[model samples]
Target chain A: MRPLTETETQTLFAKLANYTGTSLKNLIAPLDNGPNADRYVFRIQQSRCYYFTKTGKFRLHITALPILAEHARYKVWVKANGEMPFLYGGHIVKAHVGRWSDDCPEHQGVVVYSMNDTPLGFGVTARSTQEARRLDPTGITCFRQADCGEYLRDEDSLFATS
Target chain B: MAPTRTTTIKSKHATNKSGIQNSKTSSKARSNGSSGDGVSKKSAKSKRTTSKGVALGSVTGKGAALNKLRKKRRVYTERELGIPTLNMITPVGVEKPRGGKKGKVFVDDRESMLTILSLVHAEKDGQIESKMMKARQMEEIREARKAEAEKRVEERKSKLDETKEGLKKKRKRASAARELEGEGGRREEEVKGTKALKLKKTVSFA
Candidate 1:
């Protein structure tokens, strides 16, 4: 676990900011590459952000949900339509998508939230914002990349940072 | 290219179907163990006896023939111990033969029963042990045969190598002999040429 250089840290931070559609400074004001450079840990105050290895992007952790909840630019809200359990289980359809950010394009990562604005999980847009806007009720709008329940079941903090 | 989302759902469904199959097989094995009869017989019976339709005389209601069809089949335990009521009904100083499933009967004599059970147990153990011994003997024979074959192959290879080596030496000697003969012929030719030169000199002098 080698410590990343300043240049490497800046590059990673830039990539993270672009992928997550968040300001670099706002996400991690004082970026700490931790002891190991191979793994990067960014914190907004104390809550750790979850990075989905499959997507190669930082996900808004269940802990960081409160902070990202107000930032509607990166959130997509879906109406359960009496299928709230299914939505929580990480199944989302076009009919379930009540509202979403207009800027989210096809393949862009976004935070999935309930109609009540409770963060559900992280999802990737299968259809473009334009296509999703015109999507049929039965069409699939997005696919869940990571569910909040996954990390919650582990019962361990992401990292121990005093 | 962006990955499709439907593949995950399809894979999950496949896993679920496989899981159900595994559970069904386990339950089938458990049923067979408890029933004493193999599942093949049970399945065969079910396949052969399909109800065509309810008969007109069959009673309808709680006592309906269909209710019996819906009822679960009872699995009987092993018929080792004799019936208790039959023993009580039997006259004093005389024991009746124990009746068992499908026309099979066992003697009520305790000594004969113990001897039969012991013989059956010994035969089963002997069969299993004999099978294991046969397998071990066959494995040993196979290994011995393999080793012998490998030894024969090595012997043949060595024999062939010796013959090939001898042939190579013979070829080398034959080539050396031919080279010596060629050298002798060339020397003889040179000697004849020198004699001819001497003869020419003598004729010129004369």
Candidate 2:
């Protein structure tokens, strides 16, 4: 790899800022002159973005941070009973929703978490918070976009050499 | 501006005279001295002529004198001549940060951030929509498959029930036929023989 172009950087930063907000600055900051200083660079590989140090000794996936869930503006917590279903690639139904960030708009990106504050995945809201409140138990609250369970279920495709 | 323009014309005329003198001196040096010595002599002569031009300009008028002094000062101060001051060489040091606090590493402008975010969203909108559509199609196919499987299971259950009912009916008919034969003739012969045998045994013992 090569360094990201201006447009690519802007797009990446914009997507990341949705979850990390101003905290993204810390990730992009230049390294100070010191023995332990590491210059982090962003690169794209196989259509996926990677953030890694200049020495290639350490790397970070764009979505590797659990901190994103913690800082996300739009969030949804599934109840204990619903966590397994969500991990198994099921959408969040109104009955399974324990809580959600207030004023969440429909079709917005949302971080999915367990009731115990463990981040499971990320998804898009199917309805606004107000609309969700009026939905039936079986109505979908958020569509399942991706979850940690894919690490196991999709291990073959994820780790394929090709 | 007028004085500067006149000074410029005077400087051009002075340069023309100096060029002619340089040609004459260069020819004389070539005949009188070696190449290296001639170069040094030519440079010294040109310097003298430039000094003479400044002196002449100063003698012309007060404005011309100021102009000559200003030009001389600029030549000494600005290493890169003709370029605007704004385009001058940057000092050797850490560059000051832009569009943020003095020492901040990242730009924190909310308006720019919002615009970038909107641009990203617009670019991804079509992609997300296509993905969602595919997912919806997959869900529909899954639901159809599930319904078909359930229907097949129900059909199998109904066939199993019908077969079970047929077997029960066959068992009932066979049992009824056995009971009818026992009541009519098959059981009467065995009961009559038992009575006859008991009476004969009692007679012989008496």
Candidate 3:
């Protein structure tokens, strides 16, 4: 990814809002240009993630999902108490939904959060957020696209508890 | 005449050990010969390669040796070397040529912006404090909501138990009244009379 100019960043934010149907402001911020300028990446600081791309475009990484959770925009909620395995399993059935962003479109990328509002990963909406909130209760609301716990599981074998 | 004179002079020098040694070491062995002893045959081969006839005087002269030198042309061209020549006339701000192939350009290794920041620029303060504060605020709100939900559940459970107890007491009193009614005609009439009297008394009290 390449570094995105302020204009490109703003445009991308607008595109994201349009895609997910939510207002997003102060959810992301760009750092000042320095020696590390032109590096396309986003870092989750406290509550915000900064992102850019090699093509001078705005881009997002899986890790940035958590910071975006605070916005509740373009997001889906999963049961927080569920085991880590359920998250990495790449399924987002209705049983997993605790809540979701209002009117999130089907097939759009979304930040997946736990009931407690911590970001668990990213997913694609299988059902609209409005529909997921309605009476239909057995199908998937979102498709698991990426899981943050996958990295944890990868490192698990490297440092066994025993 | 000049060519014959050069050959005779070179032959005189070739008989010397230094000339033989120099020629022998200079030319690499092309093939192993099965002719005579290895040293003699190797020397003969070296002599053949170095003693090619020059049109002029003896090969001892530098010019004569140069004429005898191999005329092999290079296989690649200056443009094919892929070295970028400095463009002095162009403006400084313009993108410079990065040497590779003509149509192909080499791009630097690009990574996701977040990956680059976390891996290399971890220490730099990129408005992190404010972000943390916002997250903390969210966490506090979440905790408050959870606590409130739990409290509501507890209150509902208590109310439900109270209602269940009241229903049980009402059923017991009704069963006792029915048993009294079954005992005798006078008793049943007395119970009905008492119930009517109690209802009248309660209504008047109200």
Candidate 4:
């Protein structure tokens, strides 16, 4: 039940900024000395951060909203055959990649999606789009970091009551 | 009518033959439908015959007359009466109403938005405050440790100086004591030599 330190805040913000971009500022506005001060608070428990009202009700634990994916700059669309494999924690290969954000840089964070625009997960590009075009079909394109399918596969650890 | 009855009888015979074929082909079709194309074609032929048999039965049955009578009587409603129905005409630029279906727009209620903003503000402020406090504590600890180290270094330097000064004083005292011992030893030797000369002269006179 402690507050997040400076480094932890910076790391969290940096990761969130990748998805939310400038919209993150709207979500986390600076506190004002005016009448509407001290209404909410952030607390950490067992390494899980929570944002809640000062009255200890109406908490939001899943702070990273999915809308962030919509505004993300770097994106990779996986083919139908690759969707299941990506959800299963496999990296995106060239054969399974349907499309990608134009001029995406290598090693940058990217949001992964299905061909129909359903966001599947977040990953880091293994190669730039130009480099990926020259790669073999089996070559790795993006390395998956997390996926929405973890809700089912990692249910026990993700939703720990403790 | 006689021809139609003969066709019905022929279809009945075909259905019997199809029943036997169905039993024989069911197992083979179950294994692989692709390999049972001939069986499927036979089944399609049987289905066509069954449909014809149904048509013939309808033609001969009493229900056929009832179906004809029902088709002739036209039940007219508002459209036939030339009356306008309840379907409203949408205005030129107005979008059609989407009934019962969920819309894509995510509406954040005022209360919920306030709650979220407050939480964000609290988290940011608390994090910043905690970070500053931690940094202040670390700086204090660092200063304390540095001061203690410097104090220890000064103490060691003074102790080394005191030890060096004591060694120098001890060396000076040892040198001075050696010089005095040498002076006293030389005087005692000279007196002993003079005494020995006087004793020798007195012994010769006697």
Score each candidate by Cα lDDT.
0.55, 0.68, 0.55, 0.66
Better of 2 and 3 by TM-score: 2
RMSD of 3: 23.1
Chain A TM-score, prediction 4: 0.76
User: What's candidate 1's i-RMS value?
Assistant: 38.7
* Clashes by residue pair, model 4: none
> For residues B23-69, what per-residue lDDT tens digits would candidate 2 score against the true structure?
54445645555557658788877888688777767666876766667
Report the lDDT tens digits of candidate 3 across residue range B1-206. 89999998887655553323345432333223443456777788677656654334353687666664543434775467643444334544675668855642322234332333233223222223344455456557978999999999999999999999999989999998888766776666677785543324343554
Indicate the DockQ of the complex predicted as candidate 4.
0.02
Docking class of 2: incorrect
Checking candidate 2 for backbone clashes, the offending pairs are none
Worst 10 residues of 2 chain A by lDDT: A53-62
Off by over 4 Å in 4: A30-42, A50-67, B1-206
Tell me the TM-score of chain B in each candidate.
0.32, 0.34, 0.28, 0.36
Number of the top-ranking candidate, with lDDT as the measure: 2
Comparing 2 with 3 on DockQ, the higher-scoring candidate is: 2
Q: Of models 1 and 2, which has the larger DockQ?
A: 2
- Individual DockQ of the candidates? 0.00, 0.06, 0.03, 0.02
Model 3 agreement with the true structure over A1-162: per-residue lDDT tens digits? 344533443445443442232223333333445656443342223222444445645554455454455554466667755535446666777876776665345456677767776678776777555446653666777777657766666565423333
- Recovery fraction of native interface contacts for candidate 2: 0.05
Off by over 4 Å in 3: A5-59, A80-85, A133-138, A153-162, B1-206
lDDT, model 1, position B165: 99
TM-score of each candidate structure, all chains considered together: 0.31, 0.41, 0.32, 0.37
Interface RMSD of each: 38.7, 8.9, 12.5, 14.1
